[model samples]
Structure formats: structure tokens, C-alpha cells
Target chain A: MKAYAFLKNTPKTTTPRGKTMMLDKGLGLNETEDLLATAGDYLDYAKFGWGTAATMDRELIEKKTAMYREAGVIPYPGGTLLEVALLNGQFSEFLKETQALGFGGVEVSDGSTNISASNRKQVIQQAKDAGLFVISEVGKKDPKLDHKLSIHERLMQIQTDLRNGANYVIIEAREAGKNIGIYDADGNIIENELQELAKGGTDRLIFEAPLKSQQVALIRQFGVGINLGNIASNEVTALETLRRGLRGDTVGQL
Target chain B: MKAYAFLKNTPKTTTPRGKTMMLDKGLGLNETEDLLATAGDYLDYAKFGWGTAATMDRELIEKKTAMYREAGVIPYPGGTLLEVALLNGQFSEFLKETQALGFGGVEVSDGSTNISASNRKQVIQQAKDAGLFVISEVGKKDPKLDHKLSIHERLMQIQTDLRNGANYVIIEAREAGKNIGIYDADGNIIENELQELAKGGTDRLIFEAPLKSQQVALIRQFGVGINLGNIASNEVTALETLRRGLRGDTVGQL
Candidate 1:
């Protein structure tokens, strides 16, 4: 049972959503266990944030992945790791090593590197064939490069990724979540951009809303069922409160 | 030993000349372990942030406090808890319970509730008499009320609290660190106001800087020796990096 059982207010989901993806950036094994113990029920996916998994001991990574899986949360190496593997032309070795480390999913992203449309589709298909939940991200790591991606291009990419067998297409905002994709410089939503993106429906799309304001806005705009990614581990309870209209900002407004 | 020990940096005071207090708001045991393992050497005090200690099990609080104390970090309940105790006229019980719970220190403040100057000093003295380190806080919790505190009033409070045998006086910014005390709406330091407050000298004061930008700016303005409080558990390592000029933002500049 949840510690705050009496405080639970059921969230209104527009669809059957299965997960909350937490971005874990450099959390030690002990910290990971605490996170799992506290908010594990609320989480479905744990993404070891960009290149961080590579920096930790392989044994540590295996241990952490096992803990998450044991708690029923699918563990995955971030897309940045995949980009690095592809850069070295070692995608097969990357997939094998990820499996060896007990990761259950693969994130296919071109945020930091260029991958042609055909190659992107192939990568998604390969991950799916390898029995991995393929999550593809759309947007550039560089703000200037991301800005050059027109709404038309983003829409096409999302559609392409979904068609290529991606379980979820994440609109990239990076960790900072500002001046990228649908968010503006202050991490506020650009209404027109969000509108265009949601036209395809948000069922298979996860918007990376890292800031509280952004989470509030997204929850308000799309209701509680809207999938959000890149949520910090500590903010899990606060985000759930926002979804359930428990926080002051979303109290009666939701 | 610390990573990158070869780097020449400003030597952190051997005795921690001024206290560095960290806010611990609902950190699980594993998270606490990670925090202590990483930056425990740099920290002098750990605060269980605002009514959070009351929410957790007494045993849990004891365990956490013990961990901190073992690491040479004085652990205490936040001032809001003391304010709660004062509101209920259980000041004596508060001190007794805090000691029993393994807390090595107590914070005295009227942040969430109003306390007369005599009462505030009495609380500080009582905590001291109980063999606990006493840290008093100045400023209201509400931003509007906090903004009404003039530099002269703030300076006077700090002076008075110091005179009353308070170990250190903290300038309140709450957890958000925006539109309170010396920070503006965007969490930026208000230069003129900060300059006026610096007349108190950075020695006996701790600024609750919860934001990275605030940490960076404060470190730059007051040097790395400036006492900062309310640092997030995960950011403990990041803060040490900033202080040592290891991070990109402060590397060459500091």
C-alpha cells in the first residue's frame, strides 16, 4: 500500500497508459533502490540518462537494471548510448552488451547524431526484432539545430517512427527542457507547436516536460493521461500530485 | 580521496569556518547514503526540510540523523518544525524529542508563524542549553511578507540572533528560492539588495540557494567559502564541482 493512501485521488486518463519514464542521471545503486521503494509503483520505465550508464561500472549497471526489473520497471540505456554505438558501427555489440547488462529496452534517438530516414527505420525494426521496446526520440540536442526542424519535419518524423514499430515517440526537450521541440526558452509550451504535434494524437507520444511549470501546463492542456518524460526522480511525488490536482498550482484548476 | 585530486583549487576551510547546512526533504535512506558518501566532507549540517521529519516514522528519522552524525554532519529539524512546536507551546518537548531522535542540532525560526524577538532568542538559548547547535533563520515563508523585510530589518535580525548565541543565521528563500530574500522572481540575485546584506559579512550567514544558477552566482559573488543551504540531495556533488571549478560554468571563471 502507498504511504499516503488516504491522499490518493484517481487520475483521469484519456487512454490506457502503462508507464512513467524517469530519467536517471548518475544515481548510485543505493539511491536507485530508495527511488524504487518509494515511487516504483508509479514508474514503468527507467532511462539511465544520456551517456551516464557508460560512465558507471558494468557490474553496477547490471545490478541497477536487475533492481528495476524486479520492481516491474523496465530498465533501458538512453538513446545517446545507441548514438555512440552507431557512430562506432557497433550496433550489434551495443545491443548484446545492453542485454548482458540486463537492460530490457533500447532507446533509438538521433538527438546528437545524424541518422538517415531509412537507417532510423532499420534501427527501430532491429530493436523490435531483438525483443526490445523501441522508443525513438525526435529533436536535436543543439537548440539551433532543433529550431531548424520545422513542425512539418517533426510531424513526419513522429509518424515515421510510429510506423517503423516504435512503441513510443518522445518529443525531445533534453534534460533542461527549454528552447527545444514544443517548449520555448522559459520552458513554457509554444501553443501552436503543441497543437500541431497533438493533431496526430498523444496516445503514442511522450512529451519531455522536465520543469514543474511545463508539467503543470502539459497536464492542464492534455489532461492527466498525457505522457511526460524526463521527470526527475525526486519530483515523482510532486508530479503525481499535479496529475491528481493535489498541488496548489493545479488544485481547483484541474 | 576525491576524484581529480591533482587539480589545484581554493582550499576549503579545514575546520569549516562557517557552517554549510543542507536541506533534506524526504530523502530515503539510500539517497541519504549516496549524499553522505559524496559530499559529506563539505557539509557541516543537514536539515530535515519543513515538517518532513514529522511525516516520516520516528525510527526512520533516527536512522537518517544517525547516518549524518556518524559522517560528522550535524543533523537537525527545519525551523518550520520548531515554529510548529512554538505555536503549540511545546518548546520544551520539542527540544527533548529532537535530542531523543538523535538530532545534533535545532533550528529556530518564525518562517511559517510569527514569533516575538524574545521568544525567538529564548528558543535559541533553550536549544543551546539542551546541548544542541542552534541555527536561527530570518525572513517569512510567504514571498510578499518576505519582501517586506527591509535590509535594515534583516541586518538587525541577523545581528540580534548572533548576539543571542545562535551559531548561524540563515536568510530564508524557502525551497523554491524565488522572489524571496535576495533572489528575484526568476531566481536571479538582486545585486543592490545582496550587496547591502553582505555587510553582515558572509561568515555567520547561510543563504538557502536551491537553484544551480543561484549556487553558481553566489559562489562567484562571495567566493566558494560562502555558506549555502537547501541544496538538493542529488546536486550535492554538482555543488562541490561548482565550488572546485570542475564544472564547465565555473571552471575557468572561478
Candidate 2:
């Protein structure tokens, strides 16, 4: 039973929608348990944020993945780790290691480094072949590189990634969620850009709306079923309130 | 046993100065473990933020307090809970419950309520009588009410609280750290206001710096050992990095 059961309201969309992807940036075993305990029901994917998974002990990573899995949340390494592995010509090793670490999913992206289209597709397909739910990210870690990729390019990549066997494609906003991809420098959404990119059916896309403003805007624009990513662990419960229209911003609107 | 042991340099003005009172806003056991594991050495106090302590299970609170105690960190409930108890006229019961909950400290504040100076002193004395580390907070929860408190009034309260056996005095910057007390609407510190209020020895004053920019500014102005409060649980490691000049912003400047 929820603590605030009386405040619970039926969500707008009933279909399996609006998956939340939490950004785990170097959380220890205890923190992971806390996260899973509090907001695990609302979370779908837990990404050990950019290159942090590689920095921690393999045993600790496995423990976290197990906890997340037990909570019914798919755990995956950040896309930057995949980029690093690919850059080092260790994509196969990366896949094997991720599996061994008890991760149920893999995030393939060219956010931090460049990867050819053929290789990107292969990575997505290969992860799927390994029985892992594949999530590919679009947008660059560098704002300069990200801004250069037009909305059409973003949509095309999303379409291609989904076509190539990615279960879901994440719109990369990095951890900061500012001045990259759909969000502006102040972390506000650029409506026209978002509309263009989101044309690739929103069902297959998880927008990385890390900031409160971004989350609010995305929830407001797309309603409760807008999948959000890169949410800080602490903000999980607060985000759920927004999604469920429990918060002041979405209370009446949703 | 730090990651970059070779790069470690002795910080300037290191005399075991100033307390670091972190805000533990509803952290679960797992999250608390991660926080202590990563940044336990730097933390002196851990405050369960707002009325979050009252909202959590007693066992969980005890367990969390134990974890902080083991890490040599003093665990306390937030002033909001104190305010709630005071409002209900259960001040004595509140102190008893806090002590029974394994908390080492109590924050006496009229943040959300108006308490007379005599009653405020009694609250401070009562906590002190209970053998608890008494830390009184000076400011209002409402931004408008908080703004009305002149720097002179704030300074007077700090002195009074200290004279009445309050161990430390915390300046208010609610969880958001914006448009309250010393901070502007954008969360930036108003320099002239800060200068006036900080005439009280910075050692006994805990500035609630929830944002990185605020933390950075406070650390820069007051040096590394300034007592900072309301730091987010996850940002504990990041704040320590800033204090130690490990992060890019403060790296050579500090």
C-alpha cells in the first residue's frame, strides 16, 4: 500500500507507457537498495551513469544489478561505457562483461565518441542477440557536436535504431540535461525541435529529462505517458508524483 | 586510500575547523551506506531533511542514525519536524522520541512557525537538558517572512541562541536554496547580505548551501572549513571534492 493512498489518482494513459530511466552515478549497494525500495515500482530502467560503472568493482556492479533486477527494474551501463569499449575495440568484451555483471540491458550510443552507422546497428542487434534489451541513445555529450545534428538527423537515427532491434531509443540529454538535444541551455525544452524528433512514435523513445523544469514540461506536453530518463535517484519519488499528477504543476492539468 | 592519492595536497588553514551538516532528506539504508562509504570522512553532521524524519518508519530512521554514528557523523532530525512537534505542543515528547530514535542531535527552529524568544530559548535548553547536541535555526520557511528578518535581527538571534547553549546556528536556505535568507531568487548569494549576517564567527554558523554554485561560493569566501548545511545526500562526495579542491572549478584556485 502507498503511504499516500488517498492522493492516488488514475493516470491518463493505461497502456504500458512512460518508462522512467534513473541515472545511477556511482551509488553504492545501500543507495541502490534505498532507490529500489522507494521508487522501484515507478522505474523501468536504471543506467549506471556515464563511465561510472567501469570505475566501480565488478562485484559491486553485480550486486547493484541483482538488486535492481529483483525490484523489476532493468539495469544497464551508461552509453559512454559502451562508447569507450567500442573505441577500444572491445565491444564483444563489453557485451560479455555486462552480461557477467548481471545487467539485463545494454545502452548503445555515440554520445561521447563516434561510431559508424553500420557498427551502431550491429551493436544494437548484437545486444538483442545476446538476449539483452537494447537501448540506443541519440545526441552528443559535447553541446557543439549535439547542436550540429539537425532534428531530421535525430529522428532518422531514432527510426534506424528502433528498426535495427533496439527495444527503446533514448534522446540523450546527458546527466545535466542542458544545452543538448531537445533542451535549451536553461534546461527548457525547445518545442519545435521536440515535436520534430518525437514524430518517431513516442512509444519507442525515452526522453532524458533530468531537470525538474524539463520533467514538468515534458509531462505537461506529452501527458503522464512520456518516458523520462537520466532522473537523479533522489528525484525518483518526486518524478512519480509529477507523472501521477500528484504534484502541484500537473495536479489539475493531467 | 583515495583514487588519486598521488595528487593529494595539504589544504590551507587546516585546523580541524568548521562542521559540515549534510541534509539527509529521506535517504534509505542503501543510500545512507553509499553516502557514508563515499564521503563519510568529510561529514560531521547528517540532518534528515524537513519533516522527512517523521514521515519515515522508526526502524529505518534508527538504522540510518546508527549508520551515521558508525561513520562518526552526528545524525539529527530537521527543524521542520521540530516545528511540527512544537506546533502540536509536544516539544518534550518530540525530544524524547528523537533521543529514543538514536539521534545524537536536535535542531530547534521556528522556520514554519512563530515562536517567542523565551519559548525558543526553552526549546534550546530542553534539548540541551536531554543531552542532545542543540543546533538552532534562524530564519522563516516562507520567503516573504524570511526576507522581513533583518540582518541585525538574525545576528541577534544567533548570539542569543549561542548564549543559551545552542552548539551551532544554521542559516535558513530551505531545500531549494533560492529566494530565502542570504540567497537571491536565482539561488545566488547576495554578497552584502552575507557580509552583514556572517559577522558572527563562521565557525559556529552553518549555511544551508543546497546548490553547487552556493557551495562553491561559500567554500571560496570562507575557505574550505566553513560549516555548510542542507547539502544533498548524493552531492556529499561532490561537495567534499569541491572542499578538497579535487573538482575542476576549485582545483588550483583553492
Candidate 3:
């Protein structure tokens, strides 16, 4: 039971809450266990942030992934690690290592690198074949390259990835959540861009709303069930509060 | 031993690293232990931010504080909680409760409320009298009110707090660190304001720098030993890297 439960008697909801993908950036064994113990119920997926998994001990990553799996959250290596593997022509080794390390999922993103369209589909299919949950990301790491992609092009990629068996196509906001994908430079949602992207529907799309305002905006826009990704580990509990209208921002509004 | 120790063979520094004060906004017992285990050596103070202490179970807070103390870091409730206590005429009770909860320090400030200079000094002396390490803050929480404070006035307050038995005085930048105290709207440090405030010297002052840019700028300006506060809990390791020139931003510079 939550402390101060009497203050707000939130009605039980039949509608399921949106999936929350938390960004795990270099958390030690103790930190990972603590996160699982505290806010594990609130998270659905945990992404070991860009190239961070490669920096730690194989044993540590395995233990962390086991902890997350035990908590009912899917654990995945960041796409940048995969991108790095592809660049080195070691994608097969990367997949074997990911499985050996006990990761339940993998993120396929060309954020920092490039892959031909045909290759992107093959990669997604390969991950799926390995019995791993595949989440393909759309958008570039660099804002300059990201801006060059038209709305039509983005929609086409989203459609292609979904058809290619990507579980969820993430609209990349790159942690900072600014000047990338559907967000403007100030980190605010460009409504038209967001709407255009959502035309294909939001169920299979996870918006990387790392900032609080973006989380609130997306939650408000899509009701309580909008998938949000790249959330800081500390903000997990707070995000759950926002979704349930326990926070002031969505208290009466939600 | 650190991972990737061979990439950068950092020289042993006889110079003491800066005192880092981390902000704790409602971390659980497990999470607290994780923080201590992962980055406790990098932190000198763990501030339970802004009335968050009041929101948790007494047992939980006690355990958290004990963990911090065992880790050799001073744990304190945020000044806003003390301010709230002062508002409620519960200073003595607050002090008793703080000690009972095992907090090693207390922050004295009128950020969200008003306290006369004499009363503020009395509060600091009272906490010191109770055998608590006292850190007095020197600015308002509101940006407008904070801006109204002249650099001279801030210096006077710092001197007064130090004289009144404050072990350290913090220049308030709040959590956001933008448009408050010496920072401009863009969160960039205003050189003139900072220089004026540091006229008497900076050995005894803790600047609340939450942003990476602010941390880098302050470290660059004042060397590695300048005291900084209000750092997000997760960034403790990252900040230590910056201080030691392990990160790209300060690799060669530091």
C-alpha cells in the first residue's frame, strides 16, 4: 500500500497503463537491484544505454539482466552497441554475446550509424529469430541528419519496421529529448510532426520522452496508455504517479 | 580499480577533489544503498531534497540516513523542510526529529518562506548547538527574489552565516540551476556575478551546480577542489570522471 493513500482516492481503471522503457546507464549491481526492488513494477523494459553494456563486466551485465527478467521487465542492450558491432562486421558475435549475457531483447537503431533499408529489415528479423524482442528506432543521433528526413520518409520506415516484425518502433529523442524526431529544439512536441508520425497509430510506437514536460504532454495527448521510453531510472516512480493522476500536473486533468 | 583503467593512466593527485553534495529526491532504502555502494566516495553530502524527508516513513528515513553515515557521507534534510518547520513553530521538534532520524547535518534557508537575518542566524546556531553540521543557504528559491539580491548583499549573508556558525554557505541555484543566482536564462554562468560573490574567496562556499555545463565551467574556473551541490544522484560517477579528466569534455583540460 502507498503512503498517504487517503489523500487521493484514485479510481481503479480497467484500461491498462502504457509500457514504460527505462534507460539504464552504467548502473552497478547494487543499483540495478535497488531499481528493480523500488520501481520494477512500473517498468516494462530496461534499455542498457548506448555502448554502456560493453563497458562493464560480462558477469555484471548477466546478473543485471537476470534481475530485470525476474522482475518481469525485458532487458535489452542499446542499439548503439549493435551499431558498433555491425560497423566491426561482428553482428553474429554481438547476438551470441547478447544471448550469453542473458538479455531478453535488443534495440536496432541506426542513430549513430547507417544501414541500407534491406539490411535494417534483415537485422530485425534475425533478432526476432533469436527469440529476442526487437525494438527498432527511427531518427538520427545528429540533429542535422534527423532534420533531413521528411515526414513521409519517417512514416515509410515506421511501416516497414512494423511489417518486418519489430515489436515497437521507437521515435528517437536521444536522452536529451530535443531537436530530434517529433520534438523541437526546446524539447517541446511539434504537434504537427507528432500527429503526422502517430497517423500510423501509437500502439507500436514508443516515444522517447525523457523530460517531465514531454512525459506529461504525451500522457495528456494519448491518455494514460502512451508508451514512453528512455526515462531516467530515478524518474520511474514519479512517472507512474503522473500516469495515475497522483501528481499535480494530471491530478484533476487526467 | 576502475574499468578501462588503461585508456587513461591518471596521475595521483595530492590536491583534494571538490566536495560533491548530491540531491536525494525520495530514494528508497535499497536505492540508497545502491547509491552509497556505487558513488558514495565521490560524494561528501547527501541532501534529502525539499520536504522529501517528511514524506517517507520514519524507519525508512532512519535506515537511509544510517546507510549514508556508514558510507562516510553527511546526510541532511533540505532547507525547505526546515523552513516548513520554522513556519509551523516546530524548530525544536524538527531538530529532535532530525537527530532521531540520524541526519548528520541540517540546511538553514528561507528559500520558500521569510526569516529575518537574526532569526536565520539563530537557526544556524541552534542546529550547531544541537551538534549538527550546519550549511546555510544565501539566496531565495524564486528567480525574481533571487535576482533581487545584490552581489554585495549575497557576500554579506555568506559572511554572516559563516560568522553565525555555518560550516559552509551554499549559493542557491536550486535544482534547475538556470536564471538563479550566478546563472543566466540559458543556465550559463554569469562571470561578473560569480566573481563578485567570490570576492572574499570561495573556500567556504558551495555552489549548487546541477547542469553538466555548470559543473564543467565551475571546475574549469576554480580547479577540481571547488565545492558543488544539488547534483542528481545518478550523475555522481559522471561528475567524478569530469573532476579527474576521465570524460571527453575535461579530458585534457583538467
Candidate 4:
């Protein structure tokens, strides 16, 4: 039970209504242990954010993945890692090594690199065959390239990924959550674009809401059941409070 | 030893030249434990940001304070917390509670409230008398109020705080570090104002550099020995990387 359980004006008292995917950019083992002790129960998946996994020692990454697994949270490297691996034509080695390191999931994204539709499907299937949960991402890292992808195209990719045995599809907003995907330059959601994106049900869709405003906005739009991704590890409890209406933002509103 | 010690080509290999004061904006005990374990050696102080310390259970705050103390990091509430305590005429009680909780330091400031200069001096003296390291901050939380204060006024305040027994003075940028204090709207440093502020010397001043660019710029200007405050806990290692030239921004430049 929470310390101030009696004073908590929470809507979702026992369980969170939506899934929260936390981003672990480069957390150390002890730091990950602390995160698990504090906010582990509230998190569903942990993504070692973009290319950062490659920067740490392989043993360190292995320890972190084990910690996350023990906490019952799926751990996966950022899609950029797979993109880099694919770039080097070492996709098989990358998949084997990631599993060896104890990761439970794999993210296939073309955020920084280009991949043909067939190869994307093949990679998703390959990851599933390698005994990992597959999450495919939609959108590019570069704003210019992202803007060129129409709402219909993004929607199609989401549908295709879901059909290709991906457990979930992520709408990529990168870490900044601005000027890419469904958000504007000021980090505000593009209403019509989001409406189109939501055409494919929000169940398998995880909107990368790194910013608090984005989290609040998405929660308000889709109710408390909306899946939010790219959440900073430190903000997990704060975000959970927002979802349960224990925080000021959604207190009386929810 | 650093995990990727082999790949790290860092300058200032032996020691970090400056002090780093991290902002703990409502971290629980477990989170504090993780923070200390991950980046304790790199940290000089841990600040419970704003009025967050007053919001948590007294026992929880005590535990966090003890944790920080054990790690050799001085723990103090944010200046606004003192401002709030002073507002309610509970300054003495606040100081006693903070001491009993095992906080090694106290931050005296009028970031959110107005305190007469004489009273400010008295409070600094009062805190020092209680055997707490006093670090006073100079900057209004309100951007407009902060902008109205001239560079000369800020310098005078810093000198006053130092003379009143403050161990060090902080140039307030708040958490945002933009459009207030010595930073421009785009978070760029106002070089002339910063140079003027440094007239009193940089050794006794801590710049609230929450932004990476601000950290890099300050390090470039003052070398690696410039004191920085309001560093996010997770970014402690990342900031250390920047300080030692392990990060791209300061790698070759430092």
C-alpha cells in the first residue's frame, strides 16, 4: 500500500488502466535495482534508449536485462540498435547476442536507417522465431523524413507490423517528442493526424509520450487506457499518479 | 572502474575540477539509494528541489538525507523550501527538523518570497550556528522579477550571502535554465553578464546548469572546475562523461 493511501484521490485504485513503457537511456545496475524497487510494478516494458546499450559494457547490459526480467518487466534494446546491426549485416548475431544478454523483446524500426517492407516483415518474423517479443516502430528520426510519411502511410505500417506478428506497434516521437510523428514543433499533438492514426485501435499502439504535456494530453484524449511509451524512468511514479488521478493534472478531471 | 573504460578517451583523468550539486525533485528512499550507488562519487550535494521536501513524510525525507550523507553528498532542501518555511514563521522549526533528519547543508534563498537583507543575513547566520553548511542562492523564480534585477544587483547579493557565512552561492536558473538569470531565452549564456557575475570569482559560485549545453558552455568558460547545480540524477554519469571529455560535445573540445 502507498504511504499516504488514505489521502489518495485516485480513480484507478488497485491497478493502472494503461501500460507504461519506460525508457532506460543508460542506467547502471544499482540504479536499475532502485527503479525496480520503486516503480517496477507500474512499468510494463523497459527500452534501453537508442544506441546507448551499445555504449555500455556487454556484461553491464546483461546485468540490467536480468534485473528487469526479475522485476517482471520486458527489457529490449532501442530499435536503433537493430538498425545498426542490420546496417552491419549482422542481424543474426545481434538477435543471438541480445537474447544471450537476457533481453525478452526486440524492436524493429527504420528510425535512422532505411529498410524495405519485405525485410521489415522478415526481421519481425525472425525476432519472433528467435523467442523474443516483437515491437515495430513507425516514423523516422529526422523531422524532414518523418514529415514526408503521410498519416495513411504511417497507419498502414502500424497495421502491417501488427499483422506481421509484432506484439505491439510504437508511434515514434524519438526522445524529444517534438517536430516528429503526431506532435508539432512545440510538442503539441496534431489533432487530426492523431485522429487518423487512432483509426487502427489504440490497443496495440503505444504512443511515445516522453513529455508530461504529451502524457496528459494522450491520457485525456484516450482516457486512462491509452498506452504510453518512451516515459523517462524517474517520471514513472509521477506518470502513474497522473493516470490514477492522484496528481493535480488529472485529479478532478478523471 | 568504468564499464567502458577501454573506449573512454577522457581529459582530466585524475579528478573532476568542479562541484556538481544534483536536484532531487521528490525522490523516494529507494531512488535515493540508487542515485548514491550510481553517481555518489561524482556528486557533491543533493538538493530536494523546491517545496517537495515538505510534501513527503518526515521519516522518508530523513532516510533520504541519511542516504545522501552516507555517500558524502551534502543534502539540503531547495531554496524555495526555506522561503516557504520562512513565510509561515517556522524557520527555526524547519532548520531543526532538517538537522534532525541528518541533512548536512542548508540552502538559504528568497526565490519565491521576499526577505529583508538583514533577515537574510540573520537566517544565514542562524543556519550556520546550527552547524549546517549554508549555501545561498541569488535569483527570483519569477522570470520577470529575475530579469528586472540588474547584473550588479546579483553580484551584490552573492557577495552579501558569502559574507553572511554562506559556504557557496548559487546563480539561480531554476530547473528550466532558460530566459532567466544569466541565460538568454534560447538557454544560451549571456557572456557579458556571466563574465560580470564571475568578477567576484567562480570558485564560490554554482551555476544551476540543468541543460547539457549550459554545462558544456560553463565548463568551456570556466574550465572543468566550475561548480554546477540542478543536475538531474540520471544525467550524473552523462554529465561526468561530458566533464571528462567522454561525451561528443566536450570530447575533443575539452
Score each candidate by Cα lDDT: 0.82, 0.83, 0.86, 0.85
Reported per model, the fraction of native interface contacts reproduced equals: 0.12, 0.16, 0.12, 0.07
* Best of the candidates, TM-score: 1
Error of 2 at A31 (Å): 5.4
Score chain A of each prediction against the true chain A by TM-score and list the results: 0.95, 0.96, 0.96, 0.96
The order of the candidates by DockQ, greatest first, is: 2, 1, 3, 4
lDDT of 2 by residue, A1-254 (tens): 33212222436335344899999988887667777765677789999888899888888888889999998999999888898899999989999999999999999999888899999988898999999999999999899999999988888898899889999989989888889998889888899998887775698899998898899888888888889999998888667756655443454456
Give the TM-scores of the predictions, in the order they appear: 0.65, 0.63, 0.62, 0.62
- In the range B121-180, model 2's lDDT, one tens digit per residue, is 999998998899999999887688899999999999999999999999999997789999
Candidate 4 — which residues are off by over 4 angstroms? Answer: A1-22, A26-45, A50-63, A70-172, A180-184, A188-254, B10-17, B51-58, B81-97, B113-126, B176-179, B184-192, B199-201, B211-225, B232-254
lDDT of 1 by residue, A29-139 (tens): 777877776566667888999889999899999899999999998989999999999999999999889889999999999999999889899999988998998899999
Chain A TM-score for model 2, please?
0.96
Report the number of clashing residue pairs per model: 0, 4, 0, 0
- Report chain B TM per candidate: 0.95, 0.96, 0.96, 0.95
Ten-residue region with minimum lDDT total, candidate 3 chain B: B3-12
Candidate 4 backbone overlaps, count: 0
